[model samples]
Target: MNGDWFIRGRDGRLSVYLPTDDAVLCRAERALGGSWEPPRRLGGEQRLRPGPAVGQGADRYTHLAAWRPTKPGEAGLVHSTHFRPHLAALDWTPIGHPGKTGDRTGPPAVAVDARGRAHVFVRNQAGGVSMRMQKEKGGWDPWRDLKGGDVQGELAAVTGQSGLVELYAATPAGILHWRQEKPAAVPTLEEAMDASVRPDTLYALPTSATDTTLFHTDDSGDLCAWRPGTKPTTVLPSAGPSRVSAVRCELDGHDCTLLAQRSASGRVAFAAYPTEQESAGAWWTESGPQLPADALVSLTVDEEDRVMAATLSPSTGRLLISRRKDEPGLALEAWREV
Candidate 1:
C-alpha cells in the first residue's frame, strides 16, 4: 500500500493527497484564503493502474486503477487482478476490464486527451504493450498493441493544450512510450483501424525502483521535484555523494513542485527544497515536520495546496494522515462507508 502524496487541481481550489492500497487513493481538501481542513476520500474505488493517474478540471475529477485478488470459484482471476477504473463524471462511469486470468499484463492506466476522450495503455499477455482510446460520445476504439519488449507498471498523461497523451510503461526493454495523435482517435474495438507497433527508448532500468517517478535534489541535501512529461524524463544519477533517499512532486498549474527526505541509513532527519525551473536538484526538497522513522512512503499535496502524508510500518499496521495546517476555508464535502 502507498502512503500520502500530493497534486494540485486545474483551478487549484482543491488539493489532494492519496494514500491507499496498490491503487490511487485521492484525498482532497479545499483551500480558500489560508487555513485547511482534514482530507477525505474521493468517490468510487481506487485506480487499477500500477500507481495512480488523475484528471482535474472544473471541480476536480480523478482516476483510480488497481489489481484485485481472485476469490473462490475464480479461475482466470488468479493471474489477473480485478481492475476497476472510473472517470469523475456526474456519475462515475467505469472503463473496461484490464486483464484476464493468467494474463501476463500488469495494470492499465488511461489519460484524458484535450477532447474529453480517454486513452488507455496496457501490456498484453506475450509481454507486448498497446494503446486504446475511448471518445466522449460513447465507444471504445480498437486496441493497438505497441511493438517491442515486455512491459509492466504502465502510466500515461495527456499534454495540456497539445492534446497529445504521453505514455510511460516500465518494461524489461526499459521505460517505453508513444506520442498520441493530438486528440488521437478514441481507441477502437472495431477490427479495422488498428494501430501499428512503434519502438522508443533503450536504457537499462535501476532495480531498486519497484515503481519509477521523475525526481531531483537540493543544497540542503534534500531531494525534490519531478519534470514529468507525457514521457519519462531523465532519472537521477544513482551514484551520488549524499546518497538520495527520497523524492516528492505534485502538479502545480503548468508544472510540478517536488519534495524529498534524505539522511544516512539508520539516521532520522528531513529537509525541504524546490525544483528550480530547471528541476535543478537530485530530487525535490521534502518540507514541514519530519516523518517517523520506518514510514515507507513520501509526501502528498491537494488542490487546496495543503500537504498530507501516510505510511504503514512493515512491523506495525499503522495508517497516518498528517497534513499542513492552513487558514480553514469552505470546501465541497462527502463521506461514505469504505
Candidate 2:
C-alpha cells in the first residue's frame, strides 16, 4: 500500500500511520527533523491492507480512521479514534463501521472543519461514497451517502477558507467530481483527461480561502493540476505509475508547491514550483535528496514549511523517515535521513 496516511500536528510534529500484518503502526517525530518515537499500535489485530487517514482538529487532537479485515478471510470494517499530541500513550475509541457489511473499498479519509468536527469519507464496495461526521456533543452521526456512481478511487476532503468542506473523487472515465457541503451545492464534474486515470491517488490543495488546486496522475503517467474555471495544468510531465504527494510551502521566502514522487528510474525525487518572482522557469525539477530506488514515498510540510518525507523500502518493507535540513538553498545535501 502507498504511504499516504500522515498529518502534521498543530505543534509542528509529524505523525504517520502505516499498516502492518496484524495492527496499524503509528510513528511520530517530536519536532520536524527531530528524533522519532517508537511505533505505537492502534487497534486492529487482523491484516490492515491500505493505510489509515489522519487529521488534526482545532481542539488539538489528531483523529485517525482506517479499515481492517473483519476476519482472516473476510471483508473489512472501518474504525476511528483520536489522540492528544502531547500524550505519550494513546487511548483509541471505536467509531464503528461507516459502510455496510462487506462494503468497504479503500481506507477512510478524514478532514476536520473549523468547527472542530471530524468528517470521514470512504469508498464503498459498489464504487460509491459514504460519509459520517462527529457531533459537537461527542459521538458520530449516522452514515450519509454521497452517492456518486462508479466512483473510481479514494476520496479526498478539505475544508476551504470559508469553513466549507469539499470532496473530490475520480470516475472510471477520468472525470474528477467535487461537491460542497453548503446548501444548494451539487457535485461538479471536471474532465481531467480523455482516458482513464489512476483514481486512487487524488489530492486537493486548498491554495487559498476561495481557490483550491486539484492534483492527480493521469493514466499516461503525467502529474496534472486543475484550478476552478481553468484548464488542467501539467505539473510533472511523466509522473506516471508512481505514488505522488504534494504540499504548499515556502521555499527561500517564496510561496511554492513541492512535489515528490518516484522517478522514472525508480528512485524518489522532488521538484519545486516556485512563484514567478522566485524562478524564471515553471519547475525546479530534481531538487531534493537522492533516495533508495523502489521505495514508496509520502511527503508533508511542517509549521515552518520544512518538508518531511516518509519512505517504505521495497526490499525489507521497512520505513525510513527523512526531513530537509534548515539551509539557504534547495540541494540534495540539505536532506538528511532521520
Candidate 3:
C-alpha cells in the first residue's frame, strides 16, 4: 500500500515520486525541471513514444523524442520520448506506415543511444522483413531494411549497454537478440527450447552479461532470471514462486541497478543482479526458493531508490520485480486493507 520511491540526481540531489496518476511516471528534474504536476498532456496530436523503450539519457539536458503520425490508425499521431544528443531534437518526422497494428509488418520502435543518437527497430507490412533507422545530427541514415526478423514488444537499453543490444521475439517462436555489431540476427525460432525457468521469465534488464535476458516461464511455478547464453534455456537459481513485472533504474551516483517486484513483507524488497554472469559469481548461483505470492501487478522506483509503488489501478493485476511465482494469496484488494 506504500507507493513511494526516490532517485539520486546528477547533482547529488534526491527527488521523490508521490502517488499521483494511474501511470508509472517518469521524472527528470534535469529535464522537466522541479515541476511535479500531472503529466503535461501534449497536443492530442502528440503521444508518448509508445512502450517502455522510452528513456532518459546522460546529456546535461533531459531527452525524449516525439514524431507526428503521417498515416491513419497509427498508435500515435505524434510520438515523443525523453531526450537525445547530437540529434537535432529528440523528435522524429515519419515517412509512412506498413499496414495495420497487431501485425508483424508495422512501424519500427524508436530508441536512443547513450549520447542520444536515435536508432529505430521495426518491421513493416512486408511480412517476412524487418527495419532499422539511425538518426544523425542533421539528417538520418537510410533505413537499413533488415531481413533479420520481427521485433516483439518494445525495446530497452542502459546508456550504451542493453539499449543497443536489441532484443525481440521471432513470431510463433520466442526471444532473440541483435547486438550493435554482431550478426544481424538471433539464432532461435519457434523451436521449443528447454528452459529451467518459465512463465514470468523476461525482465526489464540491467546490462548483465551472464544471462542478459530474463523471462517468465512455469519452472517451479513462475520463475525469473537470465537465459543461459550457452544453453537454449534460462539459468535461474531454484527460488520460491516469484515474478518480475516492471523495473526502473535507481541511480546511486553513476551506478544503476534495478528494483523489481513488490512485497508487503513490511519492508521494500530487492535482489541484486550483476551486470554480467561471472559478476554474479555464485549469486543466485542456486535458484533461491521463494514462492508465487511474489507476482506483481505493476510497480516503479521513485527518486530515493526505494522499491515502493503500487497498482496503477487497484484492479490492474500484479507488478513483479522478480519472476512470476505462486501468489501468497495476496491480490489487489485495496490500499485501505493490505
Candidate 4:
C-alpha cells in the first residue's frame, strides 16, 4: 500500500481505499465526526504489489488506479472513480498493460490535472515511463511513452499549484523529473537530479508553481529533502528507510508540514516543521503501536483540520486510524479502529 490509501474529498468527507488479499475495498465517513460505512469491495481479484494509486481533481472526484492479475503470472491496470464524495463509485474500467506482454510495469501513479482529467503514469517494461490520460471529451487516450531508461520501483506525479502535472521516477544514480510547461500539455523531461534515492521511497511535495520538494531515503538510510535547482539536505537523519507520507496543515496559526513513516524499530514516527524550512530542522516523534513489517501509513488532515494517520490491521485487514489530539504540540489520540 501507498500513502494515498486515505484521501479527503471536496465535500470534506474522508475515504479509505484498501487493497485486500482478494479485492480492493473502501470505507468512507458518513458525515463529519460520524461513523464510517462498512468496507465496500471495489472489484479486483488478487492484490498487486504496492497497492492502489489514488488521486483527486479540482472536481472532487477521487480517481483510483490498480493492477490486477489478468491471468497466471500476468496483470493489467484498471481504473475507477468516486463520482461523488459520499456515493457509490463508477465501475472499474480496464486500462490494460503498457507492453505487448508481461507485467513488468511498475505500480500505477495517478495525478488528476486542473481540468479534472486523470493521468496515470507507470514505469514501462523498458525501464522507462509511459502515461495514459483521460480526454476532456470523455474517453481515454492511447498510451504515450515518456522515455527514461533507469527508472526503478514506484513512480510519483503531482498536479502542481500552477495546475500543470510534474512526474518523478527513482533511478540507480538519482531521480529523474518531467514537467508540463502548460496546463493539460505534455510534460517534457526536465534536468535529471543527482541525489541518490532509495527505491519506492520518493514523495513529491509541491511547494510552489515551479518548485516541488522531494523526500526520499539516501544511500546511508537517512531522510533527504531536495528541491529542483537546490542541493539535497538531510532532514531527519534517523527517519527509517520507508515511504514518507506528508500533508500541509495549519498549526498554531502557522502553515506547517506533517510527515509520518514507519521507523526502523517498526513504530510509526512523525515530525512537523514550517513548510520548506528543513534547514531549521524537525524533531522526530515515535508514535502509535508498532505495525507489521508490510504495513504502510497514510496521513491526511480531516474536515476539522486535525491531522489523522491510518493503516490496515495486519491480522484482520481492518482500518485503524489515529488523530492528533486537540491540544498543544503534536500529540495524538489513541488509535481507533473505525
Using TM-score as the measure, which candidate wins? 4
Could you tell which candidate, 1 or 4, scores higher by TM-score?
4
What is the alpha-carbon lDDT of model 2 when measured against the actual structure?
A: 0.62
Candidate 1 residues lying further than 4 Å off, grouped into runs, are 1-5, 17-26, 30-60, 68-94, 98-104, 154-161, 186-286, 292-338
lDDT of 3: 0.35
**lDDT string, candidate 3, 1-338, tens digits:** 11122333345322332222222234323332233323223223233332212333344233232323334644421223322221223343443333334222332344345555545545554533343343435444544544444333333322334334343333335444444543222222222333443322334344444224544444355334444354443333333333444353433332333334433342233444433332442222111123234233334443343443332222322221222222331122213211
RMSD of each: 10.4, 3.9, 9.4, 2.1
Find the candidate with the highest lDDT and give its number: 4
lDDT of 1 by residue, 174-291 (tens): 3444554435643322111111212221111111212223232223322322322332233342222232233243333223333333233422223333333433433323322333
Estimate TM-scores for all models: 0.52, 0.81, 0.52, 0.93
Per-residue lDDT tens digits for candidate 2, residues 1-338, read 33246667667677766666556677777665577777777653444555567665555466666666565544554445545443543444555554556635766777777677777777765667777777867877777776766776567776666666677777777554555646223333333444445777677766776767667777776777766566666765654366577777777887877777767665566777762221233442453444466566777766766777776654454666656778865543344444
Angstrom error of the Cα, residue 294, model 4: value is 2.0
Show the lowest summed lDDT stretch of 10 residues, model 2: 275-284
Question: What lDDT tens digits, residue by residue, belong to model 4 across residues 1-338?
Answer: 54377888878888888776546778888997689988876643435544678887777678888887777878888888886556777777888788855764777889988898999898898888988888888888888898988899888888877778888889998989898888777788886988778898988877765688888888888888888778888988756767888888877777888888888888888888888989878978988777787677888888788998987764577677888889887889998878
